[model samples]
Target: MSFRSRGPRTVPLKSAEEVDAIVRKIRDDQTRPENYRERSLKLHGWICAKCGREFELSNLHLLTVHHKDGNHNYNPPDGSNWENLCVYCHDDEHSRTILADYLAGKDKKS
Candidate 1:
Protein backbone atom coordinates (compact mmCIF):
# COMPACT_ATOMS: atom_id res chain seq x y z
CA MET A 1 0.00 0.00 0.00
CA SER A 2 3.09 2.31 -0.18
CA PHE A 3 4.87 3.53 -3.33
CA ARG A 4 4.11 0.10 -4.84
CA SER A 5 0.42 1.12 -4.96
CA ARG A 6 1.19 3.62 -7.78
CA GLY A 7 -0.79 3.18 -11.00
CA PRO A 8 1.62 1.76 -13.56
CA ARG A 9 5.18 0.77 -12.69
CA THR A 10 8.17 2.19 -14.50
CA VAL A 11 9.45 0.25 -17.50
CA PRO A 12 12.86 -1.39 -17.36
CA LEU A 13 15.70 0.86 -18.55
CA LYS A 14 17.90 0.00 -21.51
CA SER A 15 21.23 -1.73 -20.78
CA ALA A 16 24.46 0.25 -21.02
CA GLU A 17 25.44 -1.55 -24.23
CA GLU A 18 22.05 -0.88 -25.81
CA VAL A 19 22.21 2.79 -24.84
CA ASP A 20 25.73 3.09 -26.26
CA ALA A 21 24.66 1.49 -29.53
CA ILE A 22 21.74 3.94 -29.89
CA VAL A 23 24.02 6.90 -29.17
CA ARG A 24 26.57 5.74 -31.72
CA LYS A 25 23.87 5.29 -34.38
CA ILE A 26 22.54 8.81 -33.77
CA ARG A 27 26.06 10.27 -33.99
CA ASP A 28 26.77 8.43 -37.23
CA ASP A 29 23.51 9.55 -38.85
CA GLN A 30 24.14 13.17 -37.85
CA THR A 31 27.66 13.16 -39.25
CA ARG A 32 26.81 11.45 -42.55
CA PRO A 33 26.53 13.71 -45.65
CA GLU A 34 23.48 12.04 -47.14
CA ASN A 35 21.55 15.28 -47.59
CA TYR A 36 21.67 15.55 -51.37
CA ARG A 37 19.54 18.68 -51.34
CA GLU A 38 22.35 20.74 -49.85
CA ARG A 39 24.92 19.27 -52.23
CA SER A 40 22.64 19.82 -55.23
CA LEU A 41 22.03 23.43 -54.28
CA LYS A 42 25.77 24.00 -53.98
CA LEU A 43 26.63 22.28 -57.25
CA HIS A 44 23.80 23.55 -59.46
CA GLY A 45 23.38 27.00 -57.94
CA TRP A 46 20.16 28.33 -56.41
CA ILE A 47 18.11 28.29 -59.61
CA CYS A 48 15.41 26.11 -61.06
CA ALA A 49 16.76 24.04 -63.91
CA LYS A 50 13.56 24.10 -65.97
CA CYS A 51 11.84 27.34 -65.09
CA GLY A 52 14.94 29.48 -64.64
CA ARG A 53 13.63 30.72 -61.32
CA GLU A 54 16.21 31.87 -58.77
CA PHE A 55 16.06 31.74 -54.98
CA GLU A 56 17.48 33.68 -52.08
CA LEU A 57 17.67 32.74 -48.42
CA SER A 58 14.25 34.28 -47.86
CA ASN A 59 12.59 31.99 -50.42
CA LEU A 60 15.07 29.13 -50.45
CA HIS A 61 12.49 26.81 -48.97
CA LEU A 62 10.78 26.69 -52.38
CA LEU A 63 13.85 25.14 -53.95
CA THR A 64 13.85 21.37 -54.26
CA VAL A 65 16.33 18.76 -55.44
CA HIS A 66 15.24 16.41 -58.20
CA HIS A 67 16.86 13.19 -59.36
CA LYS A 68 17.30 13.13 -63.11
CA ASP A 69 16.83 9.39 -63.35
CA GLY A 70 13.66 9.38 -61.23
CA ASN A 71 15.34 7.48 -58.41
CA HIS A 72 15.50 9.34 -55.14
CA ASN A 73 18.12 7.01 -53.68
CA TYR A 74 20.52 7.27 -56.64
CA ASN A 75 22.30 10.38 -55.41
CA PRO A 76 25.78 10.86 -56.88
CA PRO A 77 28.56 12.69 -55.08
CA ASP A 78 29.50 14.52 -58.30
CA GLY A 79 25.98 16.01 -58.62
CA SER A 80 25.46 14.33 -62.01
CA ASN A 81 22.13 12.90 -60.91
CA TRP A 82 20.75 15.99 -59.28
CA GLU A 83 18.96 19.12 -60.49
CA ASN A 84 17.67 22.02 -58.47
CA LEU A 85 14.05 22.81 -59.22
CA CYS A 86 11.54 25.23 -57.85
CA VAL A 87 8.58 23.59 -56.14
CA TYR A 88 6.26 24.33 -59.08
CA CYS A 89 8.69 22.97 -61.65
CA HIS A 90 9.39 19.92 -59.58
CA ASP A 91 5.68 19.18 -59.35
CA ASP A 92 5.27 19.68 -63.10
CA GLU A 93 8.23 17.42 -63.81
CA HIS A 94 6.67 14.60 -61.83
CA SER A 95 3.21 15.31 -63.21
CA ARG A 96 4.47 14.85 -66.76
CA THR A 97 5.79 11.45 -65.84
CA ILE A 98 2.45 10.51 -64.36
CA LEU A 99 0.57 11.77 -67.39
CA ALA A 100 2.90 9.92 -69.74
CA ASP A 101 2.49 6.72 -67.82
CA TYR A 102 -1.25 7.07 -67.90
CA LEU A 103 -1.26 7.61 -71.65
CA ALA A 104 1.15 4.74 -72.29
CA GLY A 105 -0.89 2.25 -70.30
CA LYS A 106 2.05 1.74 -67.94
CA ASP A 107 -0.02 2.71 -64.94
CA LYS A 108 -1.83 -0.65 -65.03
CA LYS A 109 1.37 -2.66 -64.65
CA SER A 110 0.98 -2.75 -60.94
Candidate 2:
Protein backbone atom coordinates (compact mmCIF):
# COMPACT_ATOMS: atom_id res chain seq x y z
CA MET A 1 0.00 0.00 0.00
CA SER A 2 1.14 3.54 -0.79
CA PHE A 3 0.71 6.74 1.24
CA ARG A 4 -2.41 7.57 -0.78
CA SER A 5 -4.12 4.42 0.36
CA ARG A 6 -3.33 5.09 4.04
CA GLY A 7 -5.88 7.88 4.34
CA PRO A 8 -8.57 9.72 2.43
CA ARG A 9 -8.19 13.29 1.33
CA THR A 10 -9.86 15.90 3.45
CA VAL A 11 -11.30 19.15 2.24
CA PRO A 12 -13.15 21.88 4.02
CA LEU A 13 -16.57 22.82 2.65
CA LYS A 14 -18.08 26.25 3.11
CA SER A 15 -20.95 28.23 1.69
CA ALA A 16 -20.32 31.08 -0.74
CA GLU A 17 -21.26 33.62 1.90
CA GLU A 18 -18.91 32.03 4.39
CA VAL A 19 -16.03 32.13 1.93
CA ASP A 20 -16.75 35.77 1.13
CA ALA A 21 -16.84 36.68 4.80
CA ILE A 22 -13.52 34.90 5.39
CA VAL A 23 -11.92 36.71 2.49
CA ARG A 24 -13.20 40.07 3.73
CA LYS A 25 -11.88 39.40 7.21
CA ILE A 26 -8.46 38.51 5.84
CA ARG A 27 -8.31 41.66 3.75
CA ASP A 28 -9.37 43.79 6.67
CA ASP A 29 -6.70 42.28 8.88
CA GLN A 30 -4.04 42.79 6.24
CA THR A 31 -4.89 46.50 6.00
CA ARG A 32 -4.45 47.12 9.70
CA PRO A 33 -1.28 49.02 10.80
CA GLU A 34 -0.38 46.36 13.34
CA ASN A 35 -0.39 43.70 10.66
CA TYR A 36 2.09 45.71 8.59
CA ARG A 37 4.42 46.10 11.55
CA GLU A 38 4.23 42.39 12.30
CA ARG A 39 4.97 41.61 8.67
CA SER A 40 7.91 44.05 8.69
CA LEU A 41 9.40 42.53 11.82
CA LYS A 42 9.08 39.07 10.35
CA LEU A 43 10.65 40.18 7.08
CA HIS A 44 13.54 42.14 8.59
CA GLY A 45 14.10 40.34 11.89
CA TRP A 46 14.70 42.13 15.25
CA ILE A 47 17.75 44.18 14.33
CA CYS A 48 17.46 47.94 14.16
CA ALA A 49 18.29 48.97 10.61
CA LYS A 50 19.38 52.44 11.62
CA CYS A 51 21.41 51.75 14.75
CA GLY A 52 22.47 48.17 14.09
CA ARG A 53 21.21 47.09 17.49
CA GLU A 54 19.73 43.63 17.98
CA PHE A 55 16.83 42.69 20.21
CA GLU A 56 15.57 39.59 21.90
CA LEU A 57 11.98 38.62 22.60
CA SER A 58 12.25 40.38 25.94
CA ASN A 59 12.96 43.74 24.29
CA LEU A 60 11.24 43.26 20.95
CA HIS A 61 8.56 45.74 21.92
CA LEU A 62 11.16 48.51 21.73
CA LEU A 63 11.63 47.86 18.05
CA THR A 64 9.27 49.53 15.60
CA VAL A 65 8.62 49.64 11.86
CA HIS A 66 9.65 52.76 9.96
CA HIS A 67 8.16 53.63 6.60
CA LYS A 68 11.11 54.61 4.42
CA ASP A 69 9.04 57.12 2.44
CA GLY A 70 7.23 58.38 5.56
CA ASN A 71 3.86 57.06 4.39
CA HIS A 72 2.19 54.65 6.77
CA ASN A 73 -0.31 53.57 4.14
CA TYR A 74 2.38 52.51 1.67
CA ASN A 75 3.16 49.13 3.18
CA PRO A 76 3.88 46.42 0.61
CA PRO A 77 3.82 42.66 1.15
CA ASP A 78 7.48 42.49 0.10
CA GLY A 79 8.43 45.06 2.80
CA SER A 80 10.16 47.26 0.28
CA ASN A 81 9.33 50.43 2.22
CA TRP A 82 9.72 49.08 5.71
CA GLU A 83 12.71 49.29 8.03
CA ASN A 84 12.98 47.85 11.51
CA LEU A 85 14.26 50.52 13.90
CA CYS A 86 14.78 50.68 17.60
CA VAL A 87 12.94 53.33 19.58
CA TYR A 88 15.87 55.76 19.63
CA CYS A 89 16.63 55.51 15.93
CA HIS A 90 12.96 55.68 15.06
CA ASP A 91 12.57 58.88 17.07
CA ASP A 92 15.72 60.35 15.54
CA GLU A 93 14.43 59.57 12.05
CA HIS A 94 11.15 61.37 12.73
CA SER A 95 12.94 64.28 14.35
CA ARG A 96 15.06 64.73 11.24
CA THR A 97 11.97 64.64 9.08
CA ILE A 98 10.33 67.31 11.17
CA LEU A 99 13.40 69.52 11.05
CA ALA A 100 13.66 69.10 7.31
CA ASP A 101 10.04 70.12 6.80
CA TYR A 102 10.50 73.16 9.00
CA LEU A 103 13.63 74.21 7.16
CA ALA A 104 11.89 73.78 3.82
CA GLY A 105 9.07 76.01 4.95
CA LYS A 106 11.56 78.61 6.17
CA ASP A 107 13.37 78.51 2.84
CA LYS A 108 10.10 79.01 0.96
CA LYS A 109 9.62 82.36 2.82
CA SER A 110 13.09 83.62 1.77
Candidate 3:
Protein backbone atom coordinates (compact mmCIF):
# COMPACT_ATOMS: atom_id res chain seq x y z
CA MET A 1 0.00 0.00 0.00
CA SER A 2 1.19 3.45 -0.89
CA PHE A 3 1.40 5.99 1.93
CA ARG A 4 0.44 9.61 1.45
CA SER A 5 1.76 12.25 3.81
CA ARG A 6 -0.60 15.02 4.77
CA GLY A 7 2.44 17.20 5.32
CA PRO A 8 1.18 20.73 5.91
CA ARG A 9 -1.79 22.75 4.76
CA THR A 10 -2.14 26.49 4.43
CA VAL A 11 -5.07 27.98 6.20
CA PRO A 12 -7.29 30.61 4.69
CA LEU A 13 -6.42 34.24 5.14
CA LYS A 14 -7.22 35.56 8.58
CA SER A 15 -10.36 37.61 9.01
CA ALA A 16 -10.10 41.32 9.68
CA GLU A 17 -10.96 40.79 13.30
CA GLU A 18 -8.30 38.12 13.67
CA VAL A 19 -5.72 40.42 12.13
CA ASP A 20 -6.72 43.17 14.52
CA ALA A 21 -6.26 40.86 17.48
CA ILE A 22 -2.77 40.00 16.29
CA VAL A 23 -1.99 43.67 15.87
CA ARG A 24 -3.07 44.36 19.42
CA LYS A 25 -1.01 41.47 20.71
CA ILE A 26 2.10 42.74 18.97
CA ARG A 27 1.47 46.20 20.30
CA ASP A 28 2.01 44.91 23.82
CA ASP A 29 5.18 46.29 25.45
CA GLN A 30 6.92 42.92 25.34
CA THR A 31 6.52 42.53 21.60
CA ARG A 32 8.78 44.13 19.08
CA PRO A 33 7.55 47.45 17.79
CA GLU A 34 5.54 47.16 14.59
CA ASN A 35 7.53 49.70 12.61
CA TYR A 36 10.66 47.71 13.34
CA ARG A 37 9.23 44.20 13.16
CA GLU A 38 9.86 43.51 9.49
CA ARG A 39 13.33 44.96 9.62
CA SER A 40 14.19 42.85 12.64
CA LEU A 41 12.94 39.78 10.87
CA LYS A 42 15.24 40.47 7.96
CA LEU A 43 18.25 41.18 10.13
CA HIS A 44 17.85 38.30 12.53
CA GLY A 45 16.50 35.69 10.09
CA TRP A 46 13.28 35.85 12.08
CA ILE A 47 15.07 33.73 14.68
CA CYS A 48 15.82 34.37 18.32
CA ALA A 49 19.30 35.88 18.41
CA LYS A 50 20.00 34.43 21.83
CA CYS A 51 18.83 30.91 21.16
CA GLY A 52 19.62 30.74 17.45
CA ARG A 53 16.40 28.91 16.80
CA GLU A 54 14.17 29.51 13.80
CA PHE A 55 10.49 30.13 14.41
CA GLU A 56 7.42 30.46 12.27
CA LEU A 57 5.55 33.73 12.34
CA SER A 58 2.73 32.11 14.24
CA ASN A 59 5.21 30.75 16.79
CA LEU A 60 6.77 34.18 17.31
CA HIS A 61 4.73 34.81 20.41
CA LEU A 62 7.72 36.24 22.28
CA LEU A 63 9.86 37.48 19.40
CA THR A 64 10.84 41.06 20.14
CA VAL A 65 13.11 43.90 19.10
CA HIS A 66 15.60 45.28 21.55
CA HIS A 67 17.47 48.57 21.53
CA LYS A 68 21.08 48.07 22.57
CA ASP A 69 21.25 51.51 24.10
CA GLY A 70 18.25 50.96 26.37
CA ASN A 71 16.69 54.16 25.14
CA HIS A 72 13.23 53.75 23.67
CA ASN A 73 12.89 57.47 23.02
CA TYR A 74 15.96 57.45 20.81
CA ASN A 75 14.21 55.33 18.18
CA PRO A 76 15.49 56.78 14.95
CA PRO A 77 13.01 58.29 12.48
CA ASP A 78 14.02 55.75 9.83
CA GLY A 79 12.60 52.75 11.67
CA SER A 80 15.90 51.35 12.92
CA ASN A 81 14.29 49.76 15.95
CA TRP A 82 13.70 46.55 14.04
CA GLU A 83 16.22 44.03 15.26
CA ASN A 84 14.86 40.48 15.23
CA LEU A 85 15.47 38.76 18.59
CA CYS A 86 14.06 35.52 19.90
CA VAL A 87 12.10 35.69 23.16
CA TYR A 88 14.69 34.09 25.45
CA CYS A 89 17.52 36.15 24.01
CA HIS A 90 15.52 39.34 24.17
CA ASP A 91 14.69 38.68 27.80
CA ASP A 92 18.28 37.75 28.52
CA GLU A 93 19.57 40.98 27.01
CA HIS A 94 17.27 43.03 29.15
CA SER A 95 17.95 40.90 32.19
CA ARG A 96 21.68 41.15 31.69
CA THR A 97 21.42 44.91 31.58
CA ILE A 98 19.60 44.96 34.87
CA LEU A 99 21.99 42.51 36.46
CA ALA A 100 24.99 44.53 35.36
CA ASP A 101 23.52 47.64 36.85
CA TYR A 102 22.79 45.84 40.08
CA LEU A 103 26.34 44.48 40.32
CA ALA A 104 27.76 47.90 39.63
CA GLY A 105 25.71 49.34 42.48
CA LYS A 106 26.86 46.56 44.78
CA ASP A 107 30.44 47.26 43.83
CA LYS A 108 30.01 50.92 44.72
CA LYS A 109 28.64 49.92 48.12
CA SER A 110 31.59 47.64 48.70
Best candidate, TM-score: 1
What's the count of clashing pairs in each model shown? Answer: 0, 0, 2
| Model 1: lDDT to the true structure | 0.93
Residues forming the 10-long window of minimal summed lDDT in candidate 1: 1-10
- The all-Cα superposition gives candidate 1 an RMSD in Å to the true structure of 5.0
* Pairs of residues at least 3 apart in sequence or in different chains that clash in candidate 3: 40-84, 48-86
lDDT of 3 by residue, 48-68 (tens): 666778788688766887775
CA lDDT, every prediction? Answer: 0.93, 0.91, 0.71
Query: Candidate 1 or 3, higher TM-score?
Result: 1
Question: Taking the tens digit of each residue's C-alpha lDDT, what string does model 2 give over 1-110?
Answer: 55545578788999999999999999988876668888898899999998899999999999999999988999889999999999999999999988998887853655
- True-vs-predicted CA distance for residue 19, candidate 2, Å: 20
Best by lDDT: 1
TM-score of 2: 0.64
TM, every model: 0.70, 0.64, 0.52
Better of 1 and 3 by lDDT: 1
lDDT of 1 by residue, 11-64 (tens): 999999999999999999999985889899989999999999989999999999
Superior by lDDT: candidate 1 or candidate 2: 1
**How do the candidates rank by TM-score, highest first?**
1, 2, 3
lDDT of 2 at 42: 86
